[model samples]
Every structure is written in structure tokens, then in C-alpha cells.
Target: MFEQEYESFWKAQVRNASGQRLEMLQRDLTGTKKLLEAVLLPVLGSLDDLILEYEMLSVSGMKIYAVVCLPRLRTVFEEDSFVTHAEKITRDRFSFERVRARSVAILGYTYFPYSRDELEKKASFCQRNLFELIGRVGNVEGTGMNQLPVYEREVLRFAVYNRKPFQLKDVCEWLQLRKEACRQVVRELEFKGLVNAVGGSATRCHKFMISEKAVALLHRS
Candidate 1:
């Protein structure tokens, strides 16, 4: 519910890359390559990151796009070769190791014939990676707030899974705990910087976002 603007931004980014859309992204998103790694590393394991990037880039006749500039780096880094590789990779069912071995450069090209179906398949694969990557970034845990209670951890997990803010009632319903108990748990969690609460009442919408500090903590763990 609260991420309507973000969803709109994501859709606009995926619109056919031309005119104002292309120009808007180039001006705003240029030189923003590192953002992709930052957004991807949290959700995707190292191998997944490599495959996701390789699948999302464009080469020659085929092109690539993402929900945001961050995930689009794979496309930008790769050129026509990505298109070629996409064709081969889709048809041959290559091993992950082979894909990794062959597609080492930021963008490398391999030759394969293209079909309309391949284009759609490539786009679908890339889109799934983008959405998964975004979800990982949004719910990332920071370093300082690692010591949450089991119930509180569940609450945060539920919030992120739903992709919206959590209210007291929602948390209570999820954990099957009393409202007061959930509130106390949430309060303790907030004090530790593991979760956030906004608004004034039990019905107040609370967005349980993870902080960078918590992400660092998770990394250490």
C-alpha cells in the first residue's frame, strides 16, 4: 500500500526504452553502476547475482531493461554479446559452471540465433530478477540491530513479505499474540533499532523497515 510511488517508478523504468523515458533514465541514471551490486548482493547469492546480471543485459538486436537503474547495470555493462549469449543459454541449458566460465567479462558475446520467443523469455527472466532484487534491498537488515526476540523477528519478516507496512493488529494476527504483548515486543525491538513504528494508535500503520546498521549486523552473522 505505501509503495505505490515505488511501483509506479518501477513500471515507468520498464516502459519501452525510448523518447522521454530513455532520456530521463540516461540523465538520471547514468554513471550509477555500483547501485546494482548494492541492491543485488543482499537478496541474491554470489552465483545468482552473476546469472541475473548476465541475463538482464542487451546485445545488438536484442535489448534489456529493469524496474530500476540499479538492476539494469548488467545490461549496460554487457553489449551485443549478451543478446547472443541469451540465445545460446536459453536453448542449450548450459551448466551454471559453464555459464560462469564463459560469461566472465562484464559483457561478453557468444553467437546464437535469435527468435521472438527468446526475446520474451529473456525479458521475463530479467524482470523476475529485478523484482526479487528489489525485495531483498527493501528488507535488508543492518548491523547494529541483531538481537531481536523471536516474535519481533517474525513481525519484521511478515512486514517485509507483505511488501507493505505492518500495523499492531496485523502483527498480532500474525503472531497470534495479544495486542499489548505485540506492542511491548515491537517497542523493545524499536529501542534496539531492529524495527520502526509510525503513527499514533494501534491502528496506525507501521512500516518495519530494516536499517543499514542491521544489514551490517546480518553480514557479520
Candidate 2:
């Protein structure tokens, strides 16, 4: 189907354009063809194939192709297998930022389907919870009965219930702490084996999830 569409588009361009404009259109078409060959062609292949092909392009190129290909590949995106792959890719530490963000945005639009105002309201609610948690923890001196800091304990509890890996921005939204402070706490949790960095990179936005140890501690508590 895509090949047929591309062929038609190519023929139309060849017929309608001339000179420098035709040359420029041909160049654009060539780039689009490369993108399709690299990324779109492996729709049913391993997630690694998609990621590798996507990384072959520049960030700006990624944005452009994502905007173009996503709509056309809506059915692919809607498939259960592809959705599972997309979720994993979205959390991959090695995945490029633009690609990860684009994948996440598309997934959110596909599955969650939220309006701008509704999204803002949910964000605000998360922020409020984070601020409240911070205040509550601040009022306490020592770690809870388990010797874990109040904040850490609460964060663990939250993660256990949520069962989803969360980025630093998500943590800050939920904890209302500065990024540095949130990062420190997360690192401490990681060191203690209470949480694991599940997705993204240290140099960029990363996600953390509660470890089995944290879940056990929560159960013990």
C-alpha cells in the first residue's frame, strides 16, 4: 500500500515539476524513500530494527518523518504487538530523545486520548500530590519505622501501586522537589536496591521503578 502510494506520488512529481523545483522535489522524495525503507519497511521486525533505522536520521529529520509516517501507520501503531514494542522503546535508555518523545506522544494519543485541558488538570493533580508528600516528609525527622526516609518510603509505595516506570519529570511532578533533589533521592534508592533505573539515560530523562526489595519492604511495613 505504501509502495503504491509512493510510486503514485513519484510519478505525479515527475510529471508536474521541472528544473530546480523538480530537482528539489526529487531530493525530498529520495529522503522520504530512504526513511520509508529504513523505518517503515521493518514494521513487523524486531524493535531494534526500528530504533536503529530511526537513529540513522537527524533529529529534525526524525520530527518530519514522524509527523508524516505516524498518521499513515496508525493501524500499525494500533496493533497490540506494536503497542508493546512502542512502550518498551519509549522506556529504553539508549533510545534518542526525539524518537522516544515522539513514540510516547503517539502512544498517549492512541491509548489515553486526552484533551489539552484534561492533561493539564492531571498534571496539576500530580504536582499537588508531590508537594503534599514533600511537606509531609519534611515534618518528619528520621526515616519511617523501616529506616527508609519518609519520602523514599512514600515513593516506593507509589511505584508499587502504579506499577509503571516513571521519569524524573514524573517524579518531580509527584514529589514537587527540585530535579537535583529528586535525582539524589532516586540515586539513593537505586544504591540501596530499593528502586531500579528502568529506562532512559543518565545524561537525559530516565525512568525509575520500584524494585522487588522495595515491594517487599512495603509489604513488611
Which run of 10 residues does model 2 get worst, by summed lDDT?
46-55
Looking at model 2, the pairs that clash are 93-200, 130-174
Native-to-model Cα distance after best TM-score fit, residue 188 in candidate 2, in Å? 0.6
Q: What is the C-alpha lDDT of each candidate?
A: 0.43, 0.46
C-alpha positional error of residue 72 in candidate 2 after TM-score superposition, expressed in Å: 54
- Model 1: per-residue lDDT, tens digit, 1-221? 31353345434444645654465454433112223333333333222222212233333323343223122222222222343445556544455424433443335432222233333345444433443333343333442223556676566555545644566787789899998998887777678776665656677645555443433333232
TM-score of each: 0.41, 0.33
Q: Can you write out model 2's per-residue Cα lDDT over 36-58, one digit (the tens) per residue? A: 33433432221211211111133
Stretches > 4 Å off in candidate 1: 1-38, 41-84, 88-146, 201-210
RMSD of each: 12.3, 19.9
